[model samples]
Target chain A: MKIEKTEHFLNFCCEMGRHLVQSGAEIYRVEDSITRLMHAYGYTDIEVFAIPSCIILNIMHEDHNYTKSIRIRSSAIALDKLDKLNNLCRRVCRETPDIDTCFAQLREITSAPLYSELVSYLAHGFVAVFFTLFWGGTALDAVIAFASGLAVKFANTTLGRMNTNIFFTNVCSSMLMASVPLALQYLGLNIHIDMIIIGAIMLLVPGIAITNVMRDMIAGDFLTAMSKLTEVLIISLALAIGIALPMGAARMFLGVM
Target chain B: MLRFLPCLYAFIACASFCYIFQVRKPRFIFLCSLNGAISWLVYLLTDFLPVEAARYFLATIAVSALAEILARALKAPATIFLVIGIIPLVPGGGLYYTMDYLISGDFAMFTAKGLQTAAAAGAIAAGASMVTSLVRMLTWRKQAHAQS
Candidate 1:
């Protein structure tokens, strides 16, 4: 089954755009890459509009125009995927690979394996412990943070695999994280509980949302910025509520440790 | 030498998270972590400054500028580093304290910590946006010149 050349080109371009957006590339970059890719494929009149979750493209060829609107709902931060997609676009522009091969390459990039679960858990744990050290915590504090980090990471990964709602996941993992130090305190380990809790929760902070919202706005993508801003607010609110739940329960049950 | 220890830990923290983010290339992981370390060092060095907010703003400015240059040189998005690199300066401590005070019914402390966290967040945003806007302007000028 062979598709028309223009249709295939449009399909490829849209697929690339969708993947770029889904992988958390900035909106302006997505639009710019798509436009550049189309121009490289000999399309003179092309228009691309990308928001955080949707990409609309119009390509004009031989007196007929083709339009495609791609809707992408969920996005996660994957810098490796973004880099790969970026490189693919550059290569496509330079070499003009055939559409089938290009699509195959795109699939490969999209399906690239992520870091193993064990690596992710270890990385999160180490990051938490290091953050505790950065904040002048003692070795014991770092160790407690390490444990909490592993717990939270395990919880997060499990919830993510289960496809649970993000807000609920945030609340559950954060409650689990914040309660670690409290439990240690209840055990009378005499540690700086605040540092351990803060370090563990740092792994759950909305750093990506915070940075990307500003980046999108700086790149003049206000719609994406607003959406991302809402996302950040929701995540941060979830974090606050999540941490507060266990803390409130601890105070109520244990009478202010 | 003593002060550098925290910076080294900041680098490790950034590298660890970058790994979790699946940044595979060793070169990229090193660059991102180095940027994070430099920015943390900047924050630490500026601790003697009068205004605490300035610490975050200045460090973020340094990080964003470095990320821009690195992005151009490496041909990767500035964010691959910027997001993780800026983490060490984020007011995670302030945020925790804010929530802690609120939950403990200490309105005075909560207000203070809340304001400080908000200020730090604002500073981070301002600094990154300022640097990005400047870089965009410079590149726009270069493109215009090249076109002409």
Candidate 2:
């Protein structure tokens, strides 16, 4: 391949890898997909390394080397995009499509529309309501959880828009999670405060992070595993502190504890 | 019939998560939610286990195994299913009670609840990793044989 073409291919590979990571693909999957893509293009001497927040791709062609690294600042669990990306990678590997065609498809996948915000809000509410009922919460408790869940989702989106860090975002959402139920309880309504809080807290739990941490460990990507494990611990601590604050305040002022 | 209410709730909860995680396909959403219901059902049926962690381990295994099978059949990544399917067993309640005990200044109950919560989380991780490793080993050998 010409030097110019090689550079473009290298850039495409890096972007693909970064997208995979940003869509919550495991580290090993990102590395494997990039390596396979390069191999399909007849580039044998290529190395791809990916962690949760960064990806590095190096390729040796002719007498020169091309390297690119992208730093990913945030990721969300978008399985729909992940599946589309995985299929695109497999198709490209099998057919050896032209670089331009491949780039177009990648753009299409990334730019695809997601569920609207109203649907997302309803999802959050339903998750909380069902989980509250699953844990034996009464109908009243589920009703409270539905409202709190909506509030938590709103807080998360608003804080996220301000570019606030995840730790603070979680703390604020969890604080909202606690105070809503506590406030309701103090209002002389008979509700299972514990169940309502747990239901709302589920919206903020690091379920994806926890699952990825173990999978990374199994894939022998200990560095990525440790980073994600640290994330899980920090989020858990933030949640505890968030919940503690409201409860402590309630006990001190309202004598509710 | 009444005993299976929690499983139904788990099903709906996982379906909602499918939306939250942007799993767009209707078929995929149903399969993912079915896996969640199966995991919770397994947990409920294993009430005979002496330790709570053991029950959680069983449930996690069920989820991981089903997720692997679904990934193979659908050609999608197993992580999509595994993450949502395991949510019902994530010990959110334990974390709440642990915090509650701590806030109330009951150190004894706090310690016990905290350890139990840790044990549940650890068991979940162990169960998932074990199944994933097993699948990887089997597939690696099959690929090697084919190449040879």
Candidate 3:
């Protein structure tokens, strides 16, 4: 490969790694995918390293080393996009497609549309309702949880658009989650406050973070694992504080514990 | 019948999560939701276990194994199934109650609930990692034999 083409390929590999991490892939998967792509392009001297928030790629060709690094600021789990990207990588490895063509395909996968906003809101509501019922909440509790879930989703998207940090977003949304049911109880509604709060809180839980942390640890990426574990703890603390603030206020002012 | 209501609720919740996470394909969504149901059912059946965390551990082992199999059969990543499937077993309720106890000034109960939540989370991580490592080992050995 020519020097210019090698540089483009290196950039392409770095972009792929960035997308994988942004799609919430395991650290090892990102590293392995980039390494395999480089080897598929007939490069023997390439190194790839990825963590939760960054990827570094280096390639040596013709006594010249090219290095590219990308810093990822945020990520959300989108399994459909992840599956498409995984397939694209496998196809590129098998066919050794031109770098430009590969870039085009990557663009398509990344640009794919997610479910509509209405669908997402409904999904959040249903998740809360069903989980409330799953935890022994009554019919009234499920109804209230469904509404609270929609409110939480609205808070999440609005805060997300404002580019607020995740800790603040979670804290605000969780406060909403707790206060909604407390407000209902104040209005003389027969609802299970704990059940409704748990349901809405499920939308903000760190289940995926826990799963990814374990996988990263098993992959021997102790640094990534520790960072992600810290993320889990921080999110959990934020959630607990968010809930405690509202409950404490209710108990102190209204004696509504 | 009535006893399985929680499992049914778990199924619907997981299916909804599939949309939130953008699982997209109908087949995978249904399978992932079913896995959630299975996870809760396993948890319920293992009520005989002495420790509550043990039930979560067993449920997670089942989820991880099923996710590995589904990934192989569907040619998709195990995370597609594993993340959604394990949702039902996450200790969201435990975390909430722990905080509730803390707020109510019940230090003894708060401590107990806090420890229980931590143990549950630890058990889940251990279960998932153990199964995943075993699968990785088996695949690695198989590839080595193929090359030899």
Better of 1 and 2 by lDDT: 2
What C-alpha lDDT, on a 0 to 100 scale, does residue A160 get in candidate 2? 92
Task: Considering the two chains of model 2, state its CAPRI-style docking category.
Answer: high
Reference A-B contact fraction recovered by candidate 1: 0.69
DockQ of each: 0.76, 0.85, 0.86
Q: What is the DockQ (computed on Cα atoms) for candidate 1?
A: 0.76
Which pairs clash (backbone N, Cα, C closer than 3 Å) in model 3? none
Which candidate tops DockQ? 3
Kindly report which residue stretches of model 3 are placed more than 4 angstroms away from their true locations once superposed: A1-3
How would you encode candidate 2's per-residue C-alpha lDDT over A88-167 as one tens digit per residue?
99999999988999999999999999999999999999999999999999999999999989988998999999999878
Model 2 pairs in collision:
none
> Tens-digit lDDT track for model 3 on A1-257?
45699999988998888888888778888888889899999999888888888888889999999998889997888999999989999999999989999999999999999999999999999999999999999999999999989988999999999999878988898988888899889888888899999988889999878977988899899999999999898899989988899999998998786
When summed lDDT is taken over every stretch of 10 residues in candidate 1 chain A, the lowest stretch is A207-216
Q: In model 2, state the lDDT of residue B111.
A: 100
Each prediction's RMSD to truth? 1.5, 1.3, 1.3
- lDDT string for model 1 (A26-58, tens) is 888899999989989899998899998788999
lDDT of 3 by residue, B39-97 (tens): 99999999999999999999999999999999999988899899999999999999999
CAPRI grade of model 3: high
